[model samples]
Target: MNIHEHIEKWQVEDGVHLFDKIKLPDNSVLIDFGCGYGEYTISLALSKKHSTVFSVDKDERMLKIVQDKIESHSITNVRLIKADGTLSIAFPDCYSDMILMYDFIHGNTQEKLPIRFKFFEEARRVLKPNGILSIAPFECEYLRDSSGKRRRYSLGMLISEIESYGFRYSESIDGAVHFDYYHSPYHWKKLNGEMSFDYLEIGPVMNFYKQK
Candidate 1:
């Protein structure tokens, strides 16, 4: 499918339901960290018009795609920010009500772990006290660390890591849709061919609250 098809699938179908399941409060301030192509960003903005959504990504090209969608959809609630997720977020302390880190964490190399820790620190810094921090580790599995030793990336391990950064795990939803540069199950039905499974990728959507 093309970009248009992907956008429709995300904004109209999967992404909307996913956000709804996550129960994003209306009129809350949200930041989509490492927002790729603004799939979740656009979906959330359209779903909750009263809310302010910040679509942040380091790549300008991806932000441009989001911008076009925003203009086409006449969406006014989304603000685009170009920033590296590993570094500081361009927001005031305790600013946002929630932060979404979907399909963003992977590769537990020694070098990458520190960067992720920094990102988590930023997430904690920008979120309001007791604010929500939702994460979907789409590629959570066995990974080789810098020592060349295999480490299993389980939900428990991830929860512990985030907890160490001052977040308390609240809840987790299983079989959460993981959207990225891949076709959804709906795409296969369009071609009169059923996909082997429901979704191309599914993972746990873990919600946490920032410690005061």
Candidate 2:
């Protein structure tokens, strides 16, 4: 589907309602980390007229797509940044009111624990004194073993990891989230070589607040 088509689908699928649940602040700077193709970026940008969004991604191609969509839709509140994958952020300390980590944390390598630690540290440093961090984990597929069996984690496990960095669990919406293409929608073929489009799965969205 084209970008417009995807945006249309999102609107029809409770995108506005889901964003409303996040309670993004107006007249504030927000960051969408690891944003692919600007689905949530665009949604957040248009959600509040006074809010400015920094859409960061490591992929230049995806950044370009975001730029194209922003230009096509005449959206001026979003700034696209090509991420360097480093723990350091160029912004000043306590700069952003909100930081979004959606469907991308599972991509971390299990061996590189320090890098992950530094990432949360940097996130805490850049977040405003009372800013919030929102996360939407992809699925259990990201937690599978070598044999493809799912490794389950309690909500406390996820909460403890983030809280260890000095954040507090605020609230969460545990239900099916309608995903845009970059987060979901995989195509797989059946044993008979027939193609199927019903391959993507949805996950829950969790929110956390930074402690002073």
Candidate 3:
């Protein structure tokens, strides 16, 4: 299936099931950072109708797509924000219950670590005490360190990095599907008619809680 078909299926069927594993509390304030194409954002909005979801992205086109989806589904609880790439969130302190960072953190290069840390600080600032920070670090297997050396990325490394930013490793949900377009390698094979598969790319969703 094409991207649109996959998105439609995800919003109506698969995405909701995927999000259920995270066990987000109803009526909470949530943020989907770097909400590309808004697949997860739409799914989140649909699944937790009472929750207020903020879909933040630097790209206007992606936000437009999310807006269209919200209008089509008559979802009123989702707000879209165009990020300015300053590693800053527009909300006040202790305003959100959760922040979703699915498929956003990648590369892991030395130069980018400071930016990531800054964003983590922003996340900590916006989340209420003990709030959730869910992350799915897809495509982060290989990374370069500060000395231009290659390093392998692992769950432990991720946990350590997050812990340094005042978040405690809470839990992780395995077998979570990555819904982004380029992240699913099998989709390309299907597009080229090389092979057929019924499954999407699977990864783990790591959840962390803010420390008071």
Candidate 4:
């Protein structure tokens, strides 16, 4: 299956639903970092619900894919950029309504350690006071497989790191991470009460909000 279908196989369509939950005002601008194939960005901008939605990624191939999608669908509000996903997100200060790192938080690679913090820092820079930064990594990463062969950050640990960036806690919904939040039936079913997080993890994958 293609990446989209592959992703869909593991989520519940609530990636967008979670954004809807963010509750932006009329005509808000959104920055979708690591936006792949422009699935969420295109569908969202096509709704004409935001003032502008910036779709950015470092991959030229993906940018072209998204470009074709926008052109074919005749979507006009999205501004696609072929920029690095972590650094060079160049929007003005306090200019965005929200920033989304949908499933990219796999952990900082060595090359990104220097610029890694910039992702959230830049989001903080461009976000309006009381704006939102929503990060949804794969939930499975939080726990080991039944046999305990893998290692992922615990929900509590992820929260502490984000808090270090100065974003206060809000609330975390009991839901799947990016993997299942988009389209997995069995995954979501397995998730029923098995994993839960606060909106803002004062302590993990909780929904979070900015402090005013």
Candidate 3 — which residues are off by over 4 angstroms?
1-6, 107-114, 144-150, 182-199
**What is residue 89's positional error in candidate 2, in angstroms?**
2.7
Measured by TM-score, the strongest candidate is 3
lDDT string for model 4 (1-212, tens) is: 54455333322254445445556687888887888666667645654454688888888988898888778767788888777543656889888777877666554333323343567677788888888787665532443322433446676666776777868767764443443233345644776633333211221235556655
Per-candidate TM-scores read 0.80, 0.79, 0.84, 0.67
After superposition, the stretches of candidate 1 with alpha carbons farther than 4 Å from their true spots are 1-7, 84-86, 107-114, 143-150, 181-199
Model 3 lDDT tens row, 1-212: 86557658767677777667666677899999999878788888887888999999999988998899889888899999999877788889999999988877663455535355667888899999999988887777765444555679777887898889999998887745566544446666667743222445777888999999
Sorted by lDDT (best first), the order is: 3, 1, 2, 4
Against the reference, the lDDT scores of all candidates come to 0.77, 0.70, 0.79, 0.61
Q: Can you list the residue pairs that collide in candidate 1?
A: none
Candidates 1 and 4 compared by TM-score, better number: 1
Give lDDT tens digits, candidate 1, residues 70-104: 99889999999999544787899999998988887
lDDT of 2 by residue, 8-83 (tens): 5664354546666777667899998888877777777767558889999989999998898788768889998888
lDDT at residue 108 of model 1 (Cα atoms): 44
Question: All predictions: root-mean-square deviation over Cα?
Answer: 4.6, 4.6, 3.2, 8.4
Candidate 4 lDDT for residue 156:
69
Of 3 and 4, the candidate ranking higher by lDDT: 3
lDDT of 4: 0.61
